[model samples]
Target: MKGKIIFFSVFFLLTTGAISAQAKNAPRSIISTTALIRKYHDQKELSGMQKGELLELYIERIKVLVKTLPYIALVTKPGVTMADLGIPDDSEHKKSLENQALGTSTFLDTTVDFQRKMMPYSDKANLIAAILFYEGTLKSLHEFNELNEM
Candidate 1:
């Protein structure tokens, strides 16, 4: 009985700590487009905050969009496909998108890691690069919204 109790307690603690860390990393919420526009005066809300915060938000959304892609596929109506989202149904286009996503992910990680190490420094170069990556994420989101009619 004592061993079982200790084992369960350790398991619970580890999982709880992991969950907290995950939540902390996920700073951006899936807020309505209206709220985002109201606050940021734009659809993407990419430049709403200072350099560090903006980078974090962009990274969060990029990861969410990629992760949400599978969910989008599952919920999309039958017979509708990537071609409907203005993407071609071929390897060349698919590979292009994959490359874009990879670049976004890399940019996100590089910015985020740097910002974490040096917070509150809104360097122009970092902001410019972040904005560029953000544009791709915004375009993808617009396509997703168009697909879902949201």
Candidate 2:
């Protein structure tokens, strides 16, 4: 009985160690931009168009980011160029992340006017909450990406 118990305990310990090692070195999964907009963020207070445009801009970024994340993880240099990402040109990518901060949608002026109406109390709070959650997820993924070298 004592010998059997010893054998099982050693087996269990080895299995646990293997599992821990695999977890520590696991590849991190990044969230899709569409899910981040629809499922993750709380945009109930935002107008439908406002919500859609916000989602659209991030979706565009995500598409490019998904392709470039490996390259991004490999390099720490600022302003990752088209050559780095193996793109014909990065104008489209540059344009996507740009107009967002400026609130100018190049797709449709009617869809998104560069209007900055004051947000209501609840909307402001909710927007901040959603952004924090999204930011946290991105930060985690970025940290994991950086950890590959270490």
Candidate 3:
């Protein structure tokens, strides 16, 4: 019984330590374009111009995602007023929403272009990690906006 208890305690501590390490190494909430460009260049052997183009694509994608999130949330959530969702009830908001949606759609279309261009050269694991991080960021943003309405 004593041996079993010690084994379990050691196992639990090791498991928790591994989890904590992984959580610590996870990326920050905001993606840095410069850092990403440097990483792409270093990891993928991308030329300066290629890195610049990739960074531009990334920035454009993120801009669309961030800009559309509030509008998307507003459109989806019932009983939530635009004001409550941080959207103004004006032509400006409508124009912004329209532009953001269009831009986000265009960004999604370019995902294939980016993948075809970079997937062969890029570190697959790093690319996947970056994608997951961005997805998590978007999820967090939506959840935060939703909670604010409550």
Per-model TM-score versus the true fold: 0.32, 0.29, 0.35
- For residues 23-132, write the lDDT of model 1, one tens digit per residue: 75442321211212112224345445566666555545454444444435433222343465565556775566456556756865786676567644656456646655
Candidate 1: where are CA atoms >4 Å away?
1-81, 120-150
Per residue, candidate 2 scores C-alpha lDDT tens digits across 18-83 of 999997654332222232323333445333435444544444334333333444444433344445
* Residue 11 in candidate 2, Cα distance off native in Å: 81
Cα lDDT, all candidates:
0.53, 0.46, 0.52
What is residue 128's positional error in candidate 2, in angstroms?
3.0
Ranking, TM-score, top scorer first: 3, 1, 2
Best by lDDT: 1
Model 1: worst 10 consecutive residues (lDDT sum): 29-38
- By TM-score, the better pick of 2 and 3 is 3
Q: Candidate 1 lDDT (Cα, whole model)?
A: 0.53
Error of 3 at 56 (Å): 20
Q: What is the alpha-carbon lDDT for the whole of candidate 2?
A: 0.46
